[model samples]
Target: MKQLTIVGAGWAGLAAAVAATQAGWHVQLFEASNIAGGRARSLQQSFAGKPLDNGQHVLIGAYSNTLALMRTVGLKPDELLKRIPLDLRFADGQGLSLPNWPLPLNMLAGLSRAQGWNLKDKASLMQAAWGWHRARFECDLTWTVEQLCNASRLSPRVMTQLIEPLCLSALNTPLNHASAKVFLRVLHDALLGGLGSSDLLVPRVDLGELLPNVCVEWLRTRGADIHLGTRVSATQVSALQHAASADSAVLLACPPWEAARLAADIAPKWALSCAELTHKAIATVYLHCKDVGFNGLARPMMALHSHAQAPAQFVFDKGALSEQHGLLAAVVSACTTERDDVTELVHEQACKQLGLVNVEVVQTVVEKRATLACIPMLDRPEPFVAQGLWACGDFICGPYPSTLEGAVRSGQQVVTQISQVTHR
Candidate 1:
């Protein structure tokens, strides 16, 4: 068996390590950060003597590949995550909530019972949905989500109350610039993919506990070398020579910017393309409010009515989701506001929307380049950059958005291609 070198211990790198080790290869995993999970890791805070995630992340059943990878590593999804039927409640149960039923029907049932929507509004929603399904979610590469909605004649009520929020949450880009084709793909997979595709899987544990931390234990058991806080310099191709070998392969699973830096000397064109990718930021604001009543909006998560003063489009009740109490994670997706400004804005947003009077400022996290600005006709570099030197990350060329599933799927893909080549 040959050695497999994996750079970065993110979800993608972890999955690749697991797959390579299972295929009878010795694995060496390196991470620049001392902590395991990259962006999705938990911030170490002993609130109630337990863990808290940096931000709230939601997974759907459509993430089948990610779920399968978790199970392969002896992790139980049922125990780690809380599965809930598709629901989007806000301001006292005034939003979409799907009952337990098969898809399309579940979607219809939810539309039928959607609150704050008139009969005519519901009819227009149904008609637009049918049109999308009939067209198989296909659209021109240059079309924006806003344009698609307009062409379909989707009512403004539905756009404001549902589509717009969902779009921002998923694509992390503004509607006018977001890609319509990608939006339709997300809708198809989550809403019509399978029985539980639309179901939200909120992690009952911290993000690292759910995947990366557990992965570390599994990799150790399988005899893989783990290196943390070790930065692999990529100023020149010669810098990567220590890890590269005739019998060994190197996998660059780092983010776009870092990967581009490393690949600059190895694969210049690919690196330049990755370096040019436009990115957007995501900020998660934590507000600690004790004794604040749910006021009929008791759902674990809910959508919010956003504005200039209140930029957060969604709020996660960490107390209800996990053991954390009085913790609210308000997410401002695709945010460009300064950190201080966003936090202050979120405080006002919570009070304005949730009616929470008194809340302590816990902490604020802003990932400046949370994801690529998934705009229309975005270009991504190829994953197979060079022989024995391949790339894998959520930022790679893919049909899906930047997500855990995308990361894991990219890892799995690299492993498969490597296996075929080595075996041949």
Candidate 2:
């Protein structure tokens, strides 16, 4: 049997390992960290007194690739997460909830039912959507949120209540800098894709328990070698090209930067492409507020205004995950300010926003480089970085942003490429 070595046991690496092993290849997987989930892992902290995720992550019903991988690992969709309709509660005491209606119609109904929007606002939103749907598809490809919101007749209320939040959450960048094409792709998938596609799937357990841990067991059962806390410093293609090589292929299923560093000696040109990939930082702050009552707090996730009293972009209640303590997790995406002060400011704001003045300080875990910033118009590298060196991650060809679904899908793509190349 052919042997395949996968570096970086993140979602991408794990997915690649599972795919390769199932294809009858002898697989060996390595990770730099002791944990498996990478950014999506979960941990138990003393202060929180329960398991907590590295950050608050949600999977939409639109995330077909992610759901498929879960099924591959013997996890049911409903068992690992709770799926709910598209609903969001804004900070200004106004909220909008979308029913399971068809694509743009659901958005229209949700906007119509929004608490504080005026008729003119509604009309402007429809006009914008109509124009967007009718505009030259090529022209739509180059649009940005700022341009769309400004050039269109959307009212400030509609923009704030709908467009702004969706843009920030989906693009992970502020509206001004976020690419219009990427934003539309998200809307196309969530809104245009239909009602069932918009359902939000919130993880019920720690992220590690959800996929990576299960993946490890599955791979082991399939007779694959799994190594934790082992980093592959250098991957030489010449070694694979050796006359008496034992391994059939090497899959560098890691972040772009790491892949660039390892492939410099193996594939210089592909490494150059990897080096061009850009990344952004995301920080999550967790607070333990046992006595605080969050009866009115929005769903597990909601978009936040940067200028709002809180520095949080989204918040998740951990009460359902842990019965011993009420854990609140806050996400700060594409953060450019001082990480330390930002955490403190976010904590203070969250306490005030959630009415948790008496909440105790829990552990704060910061993911400095959580994901590669998916900038608009940026060229992405192909799945086959080199003849034997394969690349798979959220930053690959799946989509611009490095979301969970994108990462898993990219992995599946790389596996297909690898299978085809090896068979040849």
Candidate 3:
């Protein structure tokens, strides 16, 4: 049997292991952290007797690759994720929320019925949507999202309520720096890709139970070796060439920095690209109400009117989604504030927006490097770093930005490339 050594047991590493093992390869998976899930993992610390995620993340129905991966590991998406039609309604019900209708109709109906939008605003959005659809959702590689919005003549109302939040949540980068081409790809897939493609898939459970924990068990039962808290050093990876046979390949699914360091001596050019990748931070502030259950949000999740002082873009009701009563999570994408400031600002914002009372900060998690900046025309590192040595992660060159789906697709793509090389 062919041997595959996978370093880093995050979603990317785990996905690769599953794919490789299913294809009749012996897999050895190693993780430096005690647990998997990487940036999206559940925290060890508890808040109100329930663990909070490192950051609150949601999936879209368009993420077919991620959904398929979950099912491959004996998990059901319908059970784990709460599916609802594309809803971006604010607490005051003054935003876009698509009905359960099909494509084109849903978009038309949603736009027509959009609250706080004048006829001119609705017409402007529809015209822009038509233009994008006509052009097949392609845009110039050098153009930023801000440039696209300006060129499309999107209203300030639409930009704030729709485009800004969507861009930040998807790319985790500011509008002026985020790639327009990548953002369009996301829109095209979501808006035009069949029924329910635009639906939001919010997690009913924590990040760990959503996929990683179950993935480890699935791989182990299939006889793949799993190693937790095992950090593979640069020297150790370099020695693999002499220690292992030519048929044995190494897959680095670690973070960009670690991958760059491990392959620096062998693949300088690839390492440089990986090392040069810039990232943005995401902060999730968990809050709990002492008086009563914090179920005051109009929906399970509601968009916030964000500004300089108000850092959070969206807030989630943990009580509604996960049954963690009185708990709430406010997410600040592309966050740049200090921890204390985030807590203070988010608490204030949530109380004012959702009209909650006596809410205290439970925990504040700020992933300093949550995701790649995803700026326009980013030159991400390829999967094939060297002969018999590869890399896979959200940072890998791909159509999508740094996301769970991107990470899974990159990992699976590596295995396909490996198979083709060996066969050739």
TM-score of each: 0.96, 0.91, 0.98
Q: Give the worst 10-residue stretch by lDDT in candidate 2.
A: 238-247
The true-versus-predicted C-alpha distance at residue 222 of model 3, in Å, is 0.6
Pick out the ten consecutive residues of candidate 1 with the lowest summed lDDT. 235-244
Per-residue lDDT over 1-424 for candidate 2, one digit per residue giving the tens place of the 0 to 100 score: 9888888888888888888888888998888888898778877553334477777788787887788898998988787797778777655556567888787778777887877777888788888887777763224555667777888878887777677767666767777777777777666677565568988788877788789999999999989998898877773444653421333778777878888888888778888888987666777787766564544345665555455445576677666543434677777777665766877888787776655676655666767677766556767777776566677888776554778877887777788777877666
TM-score of 2: 0.91
lDDT of 1 by residue, 1-424 (tens): 6888888898889989999888888998999998887778888874666676767788888899899989998999989888988777786667788876895688788988898889877888788888999999898889999999999998888888788888887888888999999999999998787788878898888888899988998999989999989988774333454555556788889999998898887888988999999999999998888645643236778888876778998888877777678888899989989999999989988877887787777889888988889998999877787777888888999988788888899988888888787777
| Residue 133 displacement in candidate 3 (angstroms) | 0.7
**RMSD after CA superposition, every candidate:** 1.8, 2.6, 1.2
Can you write out model 3's per-residue Cα lDDT over 1-424, one digit (the tens) per residue? 8889999988899999999999989999999999999888988987556677999999999999999999999999999999989888888888899987787789899998899999878888888999998989998889999999899999989988999999999999999999999999999989887888889999989999999999999999999999999889998888874455557889999999999999999899999999999999999999987756544566888899999899999998888888888888999999999999989999999889888889889889999999999898899988998878999999999999989998999999999898778766
- By TM-score, the best candidate is 3
* Residue pairs whose backbone atoms clash in candidate 2: 143-180, 144-180
Clashing residue pairs in all predictions, respectively, total 0, 2, 0
